[model samples]
Target: MTSLWHRRRQPDDVPTPVAVAVSDFCRRAKAAATPTEVREALALLADEDDFRVRSLTDTEPERSPLGPFAVVDILRGTAPELASQRQGCGYYEVVRELARVREEKAPPAPAPTGLTFAAPPAAPSPSSETPPEGSTARAGKSARQAAETLQSRIAPRRREPLAETEPYEAEESVSFKRALPKPRGRFTQVAAPKASYQTLLHVEGKGILESALAQNEHRFALLKSLSEQYNGAKGELGLPDLEGALQRHELMDRLTSRERQGLLAAYTEQRGAAGRVAWSLGLSPSELQRLVSMLQLQAEVEGVRERFQREALGTRHLTQRLDLLGRDKYLADLGIKKRFTEMLRKEMEDLARGELPDAVDLPGLCLAIARKHGAPQELVLRALERLGLSEGLRKQLLAHSNHSSP
Candidate 1:
């Protein structure tokens, strides 16, 4: 996937001094081979104007120019061999520290000016003594006369009360039909709460304990080691030899339900090496590795499932809100991808039907779709290719891909 930083850049756009410096820092960070080198690159970035660094770090994730994921990737470096050795978490720690520094160094904002109004002139109190009968008294008399005239003009006119009339008597009695009684047994049914992962694990563990008791001694010991591993034991415990144990016919039988599930649970919980797990489960290292891969694949599928569910709910909510406002057409072209291939398939169909303009920028469109839908560009490209497209469009996409390749 292209980093968000690269995705945000346009071919014609010129890099600002700050952008150029930050880009250099990111390049250096990616080239770092050791923790010390990573720290040095971070220091260089931090040495920039505090406000500039703070602005970049303070940007919200969704619209951020340099996001946490991009920062972590830089910290992890470009080398696949060194990926396992890198500590991407440290980059976030540094960002947090920078944030603290920025907060401490920042000046307080100026207070807002409050609205003020001139007080109305105080009304003169009535005086017992009459004012000296010259200009002041004449002016006061004129003002009073003008005020009375204005009040009389704006005041509402009073209406005279109408004379009382005799009430009429109904010739026949009026009747209202009685309302029907509501139907009974209209109670709503509440759904059962879903079981939590920990609760499910506890139930599974109890079941495993019961079934393991009937298994052979060797198999039971294997289960015990697996349980310990799942619970996060670090060093190896004294147990059956992994190599010879696998050769035994009874042990060689396809993994029981508990065994397969326990392996997955252990793999997820264990923080140590796969070797520890292999030793615990009485399986060869290679077999355990393969199982781990399968578990990872399963986890990815489960994650995708959860993401789709969330997207579906969000899309539905947005559609309902838009419909209520009589603007559902705003969402006519907007949709959530229900499956991994759905987004690319939709785009391909749109292209085939000439729904998209002929001059549409293929690369920009793909990047936008990937970013909006939270899919990797590589996956988007792969799906597009698999689904097929016109020769010209395909060539244009391929050329863009080559030009953008790092």
Candidate 2:
């Protein structure tokens, strides 16, 4: 009797159910001769619902071998790896061999029209005469080559069945063909022209600056005229600069003493209206009203002047500032303060270039920004709301974010 350590069980000749099903799926996929047939096969094997087949087909068109290979890869966990071993063969050859192997393993059907396939020819020895290109010897060589390719897709070791009837108990033997390399000719994005971004910033900056500068010039002139008029009127009327004199504490003390002795009058006591006050001061009402107007106009000039300064800020400087602000907000939402200005600039360009479509991926845009800056999920959701995103899109993005969360 064999020693326990040296004892080994024999491999099962029968194929497992998994092997049969996988082989069947591959054969069906290969046999699909027309576009309609291919589609039907895809509908059957490729997932149709929530559990989608994550295949190359998602990226590559169904017309290409890459798509079918992707479908096969999903069906058999090791199919892509096994197929990768066929370094010398084309994708179509690998698929053809898979179908041939399946047909060989299947039970034979009854002969139609009372005809049957002939017996295979004998192998030619080296001493024999060379066979013609279309001869049986050449055909046999082709079949042998196909078998070799098929062998590459099988498990390396012989596996014993878990039970007498369960052929694949040890290893999954029914893996499909190798995964194909990505197909060529898929549409690729053409990079946007670099000048376009610069031009956009330039145009926007120029428009804002021109408007601010125009307003600033107009306001500055108005302020100058008001100042000159107010000065001339004060001198002509011989009015004490009342606002300036009142700034001293000693002036208020003297005024209080004069009021106690009834030697001076208070402006506050003559508050019937501006017209009456002008008459009391022995001044034209229009001149007094112009002084009041000049003071009010001075307040607005300062604010408008500041607006001109801000508008005159450089485009590149403004862009960088805005980009930094977004980055800082995103980072702070995650309680971080690290610098990532370069990455934020790239993300900003992506948005400005319309890389993130508003209708389809508004939420994705927000989440991408948040993710790049390590923002919290709550922050991303709040950002979407702030953008005035539609309810349906918000929900979709929320679900996507939740699903993508660690």
lDDT, model 1, position 372: 54
RMSD of each: 29.0, 31.6
lDDT of 2 by residue, 225-254 (tens): 233323322332122332232222233344
Per-candidate local distance difference test: 0.41, 0.38
The stretch of ten residues in a row with the least summed lDDT in candidate 2 is 1-10
Give Cα distance to truth, residue 378, candidate 1, Å.
9.4
Model 1: residues with Cα > 4 Å off, grouped in runs: 1-40, 45-261, 264-354, 367-391, 394-406
Look at candidate 1 and give me any clashing residue pairs.
none
Error of 2 at 166 (Å): 72
For candidate 2, what's the RMSD?
31.6
